[model samples]
Target: MPKRRWLVAPPAPSTFSARFPQFPPLIAQIFYNRGITTPDDAQRFVGMEDVAANARIGDDPFKMNGMSQAVERIRRAIREGEAIGVYGDFDADGVCSTALLTEALKKLDAKALPYIPHRINEGYGLNSDALKDLKEKGACVVVTVDCGIRSLGEVEAGTALGLDMIVTDHHSVGNELPRAVAVINPKQNDDAYPFQEFAGVGIAFKLAQALSDAQQQSPLPNAQTLELDALLDLVALGTVADLVPLVGENRTLVRRGLARLNKTERPGLQAMMQQAAGKNRSMSAGTIGFFLGPRLNAAGRIEHARTAYKLLTTQYPGEAEQLAAQLEATNRERQKLTDEMTQKAREMVAALPPGEFILIAGSPDFPEGIIGLIASKMQEDAYRPAIAMTHKDGVMRGSARSIPEFNIVAALDECADLLVRHGGHAAAAGFTVDNTKYDALHARLRNIAERELSRLELVPTISIDAEASLSDMNWKLLEHLDQLAPYGYGNREPIFLSRNIMVKSARLVGTEHIALVVSDGVVVWDAIAFRQKEALPKLAPLPKQVDLVYTLASKVWQNEPRLQLEVKDIRVADL
Candidate 1:
């Protein structure tokens, strides 16, 4: 890994002492350092809500643009005993929403069948062929989750074939919206939803909650009732997997959802956690992002997503075990493929000019399913927006991942004349083009990126909370940090810096880890640098003093825990 520029925020103002006396001085400063300003803000930031009870009232679903109509249409289908199809994408968020809504409908006696598109065969959104197949299979009403927002042509074709469509998606809207029974998306240009940053599955959950509430007056009122909290495990999984900010309702949902995840009754989740996360480990955003989400997404990436949806919906224990094991192996294969592709992509970009604002790489043999992962890896290495494509059947399908300074979807919008279809968020998006247009598209995208991106943003930065003395690291400090539980995107884990610290001793541990005993002269601490064995040369010449960027971490063995510094970056003093 390249050395990162440590960008530490200035210390909080002195008024913090008089303002938040209830909190310890350091705790108050930490909150300020994280952008907290008012006392109420601090209270909300540090306080934990009863996520399970949802004691903090959530937004009403009826307020959403098409939520009421969507609920009414689905309820009528359920009451009339119609065969309904739940169409969804192939990612973790889409799979979870498909299962959650399907299960909710099944309890109402409606034949709710989940139809997840194959990542490779169907690509994304509502395809005309798939719609015809669903209609042929006796589906009268089709509700889409996490997809179908920009499918204007598909929606028109489906309506021509006698299908009533309801779209519940959270992706950014384009010039046209689908002409479905109800088009519900929070990011619409004129949308008035209180919170606009919900994950795709979050929109589905709102629909499920509204349907559950509407069912109170249905003839099947005595049917299995829906518990919104019960589905939070899926919510936590998708929200974290999608990497949406964990603030506002997303935060509340994930915080409570993680609790549900830990004790999830879903046999698939239970078995998946056992295999992916190991037994008895606490659930966190990291757990979902690193373990659970990948296995769930693997079924979609390299295989049909049904493998995961079936795992979530199946009630049989033996089936769940087999599916979870399959996903585990698939995930391992996915990792191997990603590593190989990333290396090949790196080699491709090694010859690019350093000032280029974007990276574009493609090959006919590259699996379209893993293009997003490749784009992300390219962005990480190049520190610029990236596009990775797969050439097949005379077309180039590409996935774009961008830096914060560049809006890739908008860039695609500028070059729309050369593209077949394109839609996504500011940070990431996808598109298709005739193989002949790939070169023109790449050139246009690079020009747009260079014109828009600032040089400062082309460099990766590590934001440190504050400089800390080793003496200040203690159980009391750790206790204060507990209030910031359930951290993820936006609400990230705190990072601290300790400068000019003497290394009493250092040793290379295991295969690629460095363990050290360090001191600030007055106090001593133990530190570990994982996957950073190359730093040994920099820390040589014995008893060296260095500047360290780190996070306070805990290491436990045999039921006893000790504080340890997780060294993120190391710089020799005055280097």
Candidate 2:
């Protein structure tokens, strides 16, 4: 592991506690450190959007460029009893969107059918064969979720075959937009919607809201039970899994969705929760990202996504139980494959020169399904951008994961002429290149990495949000910090950097973790640093004094709750 470069922001205003008179000084400092300075900003940051917390609950659905038109077409389909097919991608977000929209349309009286392409065989987006099949099955309108922003050719194919498309996606748009009945993407060039970072399921929720509004005015039969809030369970799963920022409407959605997820009435969700040992435990964004999302995504990674799809939407108890069990088994297989690939890829990269800017490893023997997982591990191990590829039938399909300093998708877009198809976000992307262009693509990407990565320090960094001591710790302080719950990619947990800590005892646990007993001389705190056993050598020596960056966690054992320091990083004290 490389040494980490610590980054700390400048000191907060001394009058923060005076400006926000409702809280203590410590809480006010945290608000300021998090960029919430004003009373109104502090109110909203803590999800107090009711009193002075109004920081834009959610953007108006009608403000989106084509939302009104899409609503009109969807309303017509529901009234006429047309077969509405929802085309979805093969990821967790895609599955959740498909399930969400399908359930929404079903309540609105449309015979909505979900059509998810197989990841291994059908690839991604709306393929022509599936579109043709849906049309042959008497489907009149097709809506895409989490995909189809770049499927101009397939959209045209469907239109020529008399299939009307309503493209609802959140990915980037290309030079030419798809010709469809209505395109409801916030990222559209003409869209003035204030927030453009909605996940695919977030867009679907907007459509559902429009449908609910139409239902209320149109004297629909099920108008009284259109609790779109219930569908928020789907939104939370997808939003958290998609890695969208949990700041504004996304935060409001996840906070509420997590509540519903913890007490979800859906048989599938209930069974899966019970299977994952979540009977009485609270569910947070981290819970979904770590446990639920992986299980939902395991099917897509190995074979077909339809298994996970059925697991989420199924209403029968027995079927839900069976699907949940299948998914658990599949997830285990995914983990095994990922570990096996990572080991092999490690050896492959070990042979490369130490000064290489990027880690690119591939083999014909590698399974295409686990390439993304392999790339992710390599990026973490080397603290540099990494790409893992698999070769089959004159084509190379690969997944790339990048650090904060590099944008892999932009790099792929810059060298688009050397690839067949590519699309993704800043930190991760997937692309396909011809076998003959593999060397050229690798060379071009390496050159770009050389120009970009050569200038930046290659060590990982831990950002400290505030400075505090053990004397300030108390139950009330922990309660104040609890307001910032449901943290994820954008909204992270707060870390405090405290100096002059003594390490009394340190022991290795589970091969890679370190359990420590430390003190600020007045109070002793039990700390556990996961995956940082190597730091024991630096701490076990005589000096004893060290600087610690850590988050406070409450651990319960035998009905006793105690505060534990979850160590993030440590270094010798600045004496």
Maximum-lDDT candidate: 1
Clashing pairs in 1: none
Per-residue lDDT of candidate 1, residues 16-49 (tens digit):
6568888766677778887777888988877775
RMSD of 1: 1.9
lDDT, residue 221, model 2: 55
Error of 1 at 108 (Å): 2.7
Q: What tens digits encode model 2's per-residue C-alpha lDDT throughout 1-575?
A: 77888877566677666898877676786777777878978777775442122122376788987888888887787778789999998889999999999998887778887999987677767899999999999889999999988888899999998988999998877667899998988888889888888899999988888777767667565434567877888999999998988877788888778877877888888888788755765688878998899888888998788898898888899999999999889999999989988999999999998898999999987777788889999999999999999988899999999998998988898888998878777898888899999999999999999999898788898877778887676677777777887788888887888888888888899999988888888988889998998888988675488898898878777778888889999897988
Model 2 scores what on Cα lDDT?
0.85
The TM-score values for the models, in the order shown, are 0.96, 0.95
**Candidate 2 at 450: error in angstroms?**
2.1
Candidate 2: regions farther than 4 A off? 48-57, 220-224, 541-543
